[model samples]
Target chain A: MKDPLILVIEDEESIRGMLRMALEIAGFECIEADNIQSGHTMIANKRPDLVLLDWMLPGGNGIELLRRLKREDSTKELPVIMLTAKTTEDNMVQGLEVGADDYVTKPFAPRELIARIKALLRRSPGVLQDERMQVGKLILDGESKRIFLGQEILEMGPTEFNLLHFFISHPERAFTRGQLLDRVWGANVYVEERTVDVHIRRLRMALQSASLDYSSIIETVRGTGYRFSSRSVVPAAERFEASGMHSAHWQ
Target chain B: MKDPLILVIEDEESIRGMLRMALEIAGFECIEADNIQSGHTMIANKRPDLVLLDWMLPGGNGIELLRRLKREDSTKELPVIMLTAKTTEDNMVQGLEVGADDYVTKPFAPRELIARIKALLRRSPGVLQDERMQVGKLILDGESKRIFLGQEILEMGPTEFNLLHFFISHPERAFTRGQLLDRVWGANVYVEERTVDVHIRRLRMALQSASLDYSSIIETVRGTGYRFSSRSVVPAAERFEASGMHSAHWQ
Candidate 1:
């Protein structure tokens, strides 16, 4: 798959530079614009996967652009994260009511920004494409909240399905039990990381019943966290080709 | 300085274990309490620098403990970060209204937790003592929003003052431009991370006029970000002694 493209629209050259560097390093293609005129043109032309928009911009107000984007069907569904210095609750509500998918205040940790971007991207149409995703003969029907192996349905809890869905959608990456809780269980839900281990066991058992061996697929990095691999497991040789999965071992 | 002690008030062993591992690795002392009864006792006896609280407990609700802590003069100023599975707006409002220093949703990245922990610790009474902080000859008065070298006030912009205040409160720490923006600028603002450099430069210039060569204090961490050091910087030994700052590189 091609790298996801993100549009960074801000008035500050230094901030734009920082975003460009950070986004590219995080494996996303970035296009920059310093003002609303260019921002609108870029959105209309490049059609980015997501936008990192500044609340205060030159030539136009960010909230106004957000309103326009939401008003027009062509851009309405585009995922956006408003970058603003405003920290008040009223400001956040206004931004959300105007249809921002997320909010990252000024001076945000690049990792936080990247996390929010990744989360928003996961929900974007380009990534979701459809409600169903297939890997090998295994199928995940998100719309129906069901997993299928060939024609047979796999019985699992909603949490297991959500966990599997997240893994499949974001394969070849390690997720800390914490990240799993945030991504699969929703950020605010206070489930234990061991709860992740329990669910992983259940998921593997369910997949095993369907003649799939998860012991190799959901590889656990000792003392670090868990990861989802698309490649065959059990042998050290196959692991070399799946190097990307190890990149996030710090998780 | 001794490592800050953090009390983990949570019931889940797995989550508590994760917090312990993460906290100890980050150079902080941690004490775990599974219930509010023990939690209150720990607070009274141990008097930790901060608290990583779980919203739900076996015997008492986390919010109840928060209210009780805030109401009492002894613990009222204690900084608490509520770990919750509750992400609803009303829930957050309630948590904040009850006086949680911050909030970290469940399934948080270890780095995110550490960041909030560090930020809250910086605000805790033991650290702040007063609205003022002293480092060498520099005096940062939070209430007045002013910095003084001995007796004279240093001239700077609001952003520069905020940046300096954060650096003073969190000395011997290296923070990336993104982290600086998040910490100093307020996370939601869409300012460029490089804007940090501009304010930093301005701050340095202002400090230099007071005969303080900030080039040594605000050391650049080649390919990483920036750090504010208390020790003299020309030698490699001081850098090793100042290593505590790197614990937050993951942020």
Candidate 2:
């Protein structure tokens, strides 16, 4: 691929110079703007791969530019990494909530800035899109945050929904409680790994009440973890196919 | 270092016979429990290195037994593998989410069962433990999900927390986005590699807000990924001590 073009939007000439030097050395092509107005124009004209946006621009801030870019369909997916000195929880959360892919504090190391830019530019667009999945009679629409068994909708908590989504997406793989905690509970949540068991039970109970034998669907992998198996819940004939077994007879 | 003892808990006489024979042949000492109640007794009495539990038993299901074991501190860490006819998503998820170490479906190849058991037993206990680390003024306590610069706590999102944890644990090692996602995010997650950038920036922002200047702490390995450097974040006097670079000097 040609060198990824990075658009730097900062009012400080020195910071911009540092960024340009670091980016060039890191083999990235770059363009510059002193404020959002020029930044907007540069983006429209140049269509750079990513924007290294300053949190505080000359006129309006980077957040404003981020909002505008996200609002417009053509630029909605343009990746932006905010350069800011703000590191408060509220500020960082707000920046991310506004769809800044990432943010670097001012006085950032050249290598850190370049790494952030490379990472943002390398991201695929589908990462932001909600997906829909179907397995047998079950349907999960991630965008809608809804699940269906055939035509009937299943009521489940958001956490349960996420857990189910993960399991379905990664079928047949067994995961430990610790792994489940990291994956389903989010990596840094610090909840007891056993919490996974409670949620699993809740999910299973929900499925059970819906008249599905949940155990068959979520087979227990003794001593290891759990797996989403198509065969366990199906009739014996169907199970053979689900497990990739050609012969039905085990004896 | 005696051969690991494996407890086989299955109601089927033939299956139990097969497991005992297979386990013995695999050089494992075997114990048998025909139901959940008996399995509990055997575990309490024998303290087998691993349990091969069946999903269905004579009196109660294996999940109930699992819940009881995991609830108790002494037996909570005991590795368990579930043997079941159930292979559907719900069943597998329930079993896994409920804390079965791993599971194998009925008519499972003896080799497959042995392999799963071996894998589960091979997992180090450290994987399940919450560890704490100190890097200069930075204190990361995994159990509490807290990071501190001196006495002040730094607030960050779950992803950022995990990224920092991974970086600190394996300091100075450059990790590609793909590797970061695998080690920090669970292996099965299909997130965009660029998402690592978002988390890395978030971590840096958290560190920076606390006057940590983590750019030095989390170094960018250009054309690669990221690293945590003791020298960058610590004062010159402390850097020598932190990195063990006491004799080296830059001209």
Candidate 3:
């Protein structure tokens, strides 16, 4: 709810300046990136609360940059609004599929773009928590945006981090992939259920790399999807023993 | 930007009173319905900008009314936040699955509920444009929230109105079921893609009932889902001739 700083990733100097002027007039602090590479670097260096990415950068297009950001653990959760041209609506859809949070077509009213920026920022993933969370050996420092297993840091994609953060927050309960998609990814997205599987796998992998056998905390419920339990995480043989008489049953 | 009137459909009088006080304190006008039957009526008559529904009611639960509202094109777009008790989390999932926009666990802080209400209203479907739109004989009056074909009014569920509204606004372009779900239902909802097919069928049926052959504008684009073309209303055989070969291809 604080005054948000916005990063403008537009290749065109005129568009970037235009956006900065508009955003500043609306009382938002703004930064600029003229190409995809700089945009990505700026995102890492500046840590802007939200990003306004232009779809057609010279060295790499906006979709490429968007995909990279979404793929990375560090920047995946950043709210990104792509600036697109009216004729390139297909590219806009592609950008959305690759995880651009929202988009504004070029030749759009500046008012409309600012409105979208405000809306996207209002419920951005950043607003959810700023606390340290722990489940057994795993510790998620929401304030610093880092995860640790015992002593080692568990590095993962932004989505993976978010998935782990959610699991740590709500342990001992099964979440269907749909529910995970709704909660961890935020309800506004239209991501595929398969994406949840990919992120879960990456999260477990991150945990495993940090500490062997640590990944067993994340359990797969046959018909129900995934769940995280902080109890005895010994792989398969002790699984039945770990899940005592009060067992989870799926219909 | 106007002061939002929120309807709290909670059965417990104590909780209801608590909510009214909290909402009123937050500058929201409040109304209440103690059960599902009256809840539905209040929604129809009162037209609150947002709804806070408690999952359990005496005769029929809140899911029943949520389903009924989502099924009707008239109330489907209404923003509903289910007031779920923490113990009945599964019921909360069911409420969300049935199309309640968001949910808050009961014994929730008044501040959290007010925040959810504010966030939901910030991007409610009601905040979109209010202008009458025309596509062929079909006239979509965004101001009155009605659809008309020739002289007769075409009544639709709120979702259908939104779908038709979207289609009329973005005509001649095919949209996948996922895209339709995101655009029409609002990006925040996690509705199944199959729901799009059901709504499209209903919208077409409503158009057909008002007039004999007016349903042809809502055409299925084979593998691509659907599109609204105001050019030709003729079904099937004339379809090939009507699509005189700036043809669409699906991979």
Best by TM-score: 1
The weakest ten consecutive residues by lDDT in model 1 chain A span A242-251
lDDT of 2 by residue, A122-168 (tens): 46432311556655566677667787776678888988887887676
Could you give candidate 3's per-residue lDDT for residues B36-99 as a string of tens digits? 8888888989898888888888879778888888999988788998877665768777777889
> DockQ for each candidate?
0.02, 0.01, 0.02
| Residue A231, model 1: Cα distance from true site in angstroms | 3.2
Q: Which stretches of candidate 2 lie over 4 Å from their true place?
A: A1-76, A86-129, A209-211, A234-251, B1-251
lDDT string for model 3 (A60-99, tens) is: 8778888788778788668888888765546654665566
| Candidate 3 chain A: 10-residue stretch with minimal lDDT | A242-251
Q: What would the DockQ be for model 3?
A: 0.02
For model 3, the stretches where C-alpha displacement exceeds 4 angstroms are A125-127, A130-251, B1-251
Compare the candidates by lDDT and give the number of the best one: 1
For model 1, the DockQ equals: 0.02
Model 2 residue B1 distance off true place after TM-score fit, in angstroms: 11
For candidate 1, the TM-score of chain A alone versus the native chain A is 0.57
lDDT (C-alpha) at residue A188 in model 3: 55
- Please rank every candidate by TM-score, starting with the best: 1, 2, 3
Tens-place lDDT digits, model 2, residues B66-166: 87886688986788888889667566646655566566888799977876676556443334545667777787765445676875667777678778877
Candidate 2 chain A lDDT trough over 10 residues, lowest sum: A242-251
